[model samples]
Target chain A: MRTIKLTLNGTSVSREIEDNRLLVEFLREDMKLTGTKESCGVGVCGACTVLLDGTPISACLALAVHADGRAVTTIEGIADGDRLHPLQESFLRHGGFQCGICTPGQILAAKALLDANPHPTRAEIQHWMMGNLCRCTGYYKIIESIAAAAGAE
Target chain B: MVPFTYLEPASLDEALALLAEHGEDAKLIAGGTGLVNLMKQRLVRPDFVIGLRAIRALAGISEKDGLRIGALATIQSLEVSELVRRHAPLLAEACGHVATVRVRSMATLGGAMAHGDPNLDTPPALIAMDGQIVARTRRGERTIPVDRFFTGYFGTVLERDEIVTELLIPKQPAGSGTAFLKFLPATQDDYATVSVATRIALGADGTIREARVALGAAAMVPVRARMVEAALSGKASDEKTLGDAAPLVVDAIDPIADFRGSAEYKREMAVVHVRRALVEAAAKAKEAR
Candidate 1:
């Protein structure tokens, strides 16, 4: 076991994790940041996506130990105490999700995209979200939400 | 995916030392995009994972001696860099077509190179530029040509305890041009069907002075289409020369059957991609000149 020091959301959080602990487990279980979802416990599906050092990475694939001292932001981190992220607002307005299973990942992926590319073209938006699969097949709606958010930006 | 002791070494030296101690029982974790997926499928069962995240030196991109790409330079970084686009447009263009934006942000150059997936888009493109991979270990440091990086499918010449530290892509001549084309499998995203990277330099007389053709996903290692190059030499390359060169490349390669493509289909696509890449790259070279 190793004690890791890192920042989560807007807080400085530290903990000791098992040598084999995956970041997805630490986030969803230990930290109780259940907002971040996990479908494929592999990197293929971006359901476990989180911004690690400002990049959307799969929490399931990242070893908890590897995240030591790194800044991690889960879906739970996006909004302020009582506010919603702009992308979240656009998602709600557009009904960006169907079953909501891929919502957290979709939102987080969009947030990362908009963070790097404040105004992305429609093709760029589709190209960026290619890794995160939506089994719900609400891709057009999701793409619309992200595009609408970009237009607003 | 299984339980394993994870170590995040703060320095390259520390990481190499840990790897030296653990040897084959240990695996190096970079972005963990591909490695973790394979591990989850029980394809990789290492007892230890040496995470390279903390090694600051392995994580950024900058120019030195032509172009020095840090081992951990993310695909997103390459795709987003104006320097990469200017210095090596083929690299930027090829990386831009990687899985997706989020994946590109998480996937590192060295990790992808070290992962040694035959279908990977960047390696063949990089190899076409005659790139060199620099690796370091507790034992010592060694350099491997990008063309010789892979030994087999999902396998590399990387020895235990060694970590790739840098990639050196020679900056092209002022007027040279390059292009890459990839055929994604219709069934899955995990593999590549046929991919080609071609670079051509035109002479003052406007014929092919130099040519490099690299093909991936059609062989165990990225194949350099020597016969295609020979066929293209000093020719008035129009669509015809490119068309003729493609089949020469097709004959030169020995593709294998995989879930992504049948050997026959792969060989055919290899021809198609080579034709397209050659035509595109040759035109670009002529325009640049």
Candidate 2:
């Protein structure tokens, strides 16, 4: 076991986690921050995407111990109290999701993209969000949502 | 994942000491993109998992005599690095092609080399550029040419107590041009059906001064197409010359039949892609000249 202190969302938290515990498990099981989903245990799918030090990474492939002394942002951290983040609002406004299993990850991944490039083009949005799979939306709506979010910003 | 005591070493010396102490019982974890998946699959069950992220010294890209890339530098960082793009754009292009942005953010270049996956895009680029793997043990350090770094599938010559410290890529010749082509018939992120990286340098006389050809996903180990390189050296930088040399690549690669392609199909694709890469590289070389 190891004690890892990290900035989650905006608040700092310390926890004693198993050495083998993945970042996804730490967020969902221990912290009850189930906003990050783990659909593909491998790194191929971005369902478990979370921002580590302001960069998106596969939580399932990242160990909790690696989060030590770093900042991690998840989907739960996206909203501002009652007010939803612009990306979240844009997703809703554009009908970005269908089944919604990939919504959280999609939002977080898009959040990272906008944070890096506030005004990404349609091609840029497609390239960045390609890893976050949405079986229902066929990706056009997701692209629309992200582009709308970028424009709104 | 099997339970293991995680060790975080803050310094390279400490990490080397830990490796020496644990020997075969310990496994080093870098970006965790590769090692973590192996652990989850129960392919590796190390008693002690050494975390290398804490060693801040082993991170960053710097240009000395050549480009010196620290092992801990993330693929994303390398892809965006101005120095990398300016000096070795083929490497930057290869780094950008890996998996996705998320994987690139977490996967380290050193970890990629140590993982020794034959299908990875970086190895061929490294080999074509004459990159060297700088590995270190408690005793000393040694440089292994990237082309000879991988021993077999998922294997390298790294010792049980050794760690890859950095990758050293020498400067390309003045009239050199390089190309990295990955044939992905499936998803953009999927491993290549046949990947080719080629570097062509033209002499002032317009003959091929030197040539380097390397391939990935075309063999159990990243193949350095020495035969193809030999065929191109001193030859005219023309379509026919490149076409003749490209077929010689078939003698170097022994691809396995899988969902990506049949062995024979991969061989054919290898020849075609190598020729295309050569042609593109030759055009760039002419422009550079």
Candidate 3:
């Protein structure tokens, strides 16, 4: 086991975790932040996407110990207490999800894209969100959500 | 994943000490995007995982006589690095297409090369650019040419006690152009069915002065199509010549039948992509002149 200290959801979190524990497990089981889902643990599906130091990374493949002294922002951290983030509101407004299992990852990945390129073109949005697969929505609404959020932000 | 002792060394000396102590029992993990997945599948079970993430010296992009890409530099950094874009755009383009944004943010260039996966996108690009892998151990430092790095499937010349520290890619010569072409029949993020990377240096006379052609997913390792290169050198970069030279790649590659395609189909596609890559690179070389 190893002890790691990290800023999670804008709060510093220090915890003891097994060396093999994945960041997804640390966020869901240990920190009780089940907002991040691990549908495809192999990093192909971006269902476990989270912001590490403001960059999108696969939490499933990352070891919790590797998150030491870093900042992690999950789906749970995006809203401002009773108020939804622009991305969350945009996603909801645009009906960006049907199954909703892939919504968190889609929003997080979109957030990273907009953070890096605020005014990305539709092509850029498609290119960036290619990894976050949403079988139900057909990805049109997700793209609209990101584009809308980009304008609002 | 199987339980293992995690050791994060603060310095290169400490990491080398741990490797020297554990030897074959230790696995050096950078980014952990590749090694961890293998561990999860029970494909690789190491008693000790030496995390290289803490070694801050192993992450940066610098250029002198050539480009020095730190071993821990993420693929996403390479994709956006202006230095890499100016020096080696082929690498940047290849890195941009690897897996996805999230995976690229966590996958390191050195880790990708050390992983020695034939389906990977960077190996052919690096091999075509004549890159070198720098490895270090308590014994000393050694440089292995990227062309000679991979030994077999999921294998390299690296010893258990040695760790890859950086990748040194020399600047391209004048009048040289490079192209990396990947044939992804499925999703955008899927591994290429057959990928080709070509570097063509044109002479003042408009003939191919020198050529390097490498293919990914062609064999157990990234195949340097030397026969194709030899056939094109000193020849005019024209349609007939390329058509003749393209078929020679089949002689150099031994592809396996997988879900991507049959071995026979891949060999045929290799010829097509090699031809296209060489043609595109030749055009760029002409433009550079």
Model 3 local distance difference test score: 0.92
TM-score of chain A of each: 0.96, 0.98, 0.97
- Taking the tens digit of each residue's C-alpha lDDT, what string does model 1 give over B1-289? 5777887788988898899899989998888778777777788889998888778988667777578899899898998788788788888888977776656777899999999887788998898888899999777889899988888878899998789999888878655779988888562345568888999888898888888899877887777888898888898768887787789887668888877778998898899889999999988998898
Fnat of each prediction? 0.65, 0.82, 0.88
Question: Residues B85-188, candidate 2, lDDT per residue (tens digit)?
Answer: 99999999899889999999999999999999999999999999999999999999999999989999998999999999999999899899999999999998
Could you arrange the candidates by lDDT from highest to lowest? 2, 3, 1
Candidate 1 residue B118 C-alpha distance from true site, Å: 0.7
What DockQ was computed for model 2? 0.87
lDDT of 2: 0.93
RMSD of each: 2.0, 0.8, 0.8
DockQ of each: 0.59, 0.87, 0.90
Q: Model 3, residue A38: what's the lDDT?
A: 91
Off by over 4 Å in 1: B185-190
Kindly report which residue stretches of model 3 are placed more than 4 angstroms away from their true locations once superposed. Answer: none
**Candidate 3 CAPRI level:** high
Whole-model Cα lDDT per candidate?
0.84, 0.93, 0.92
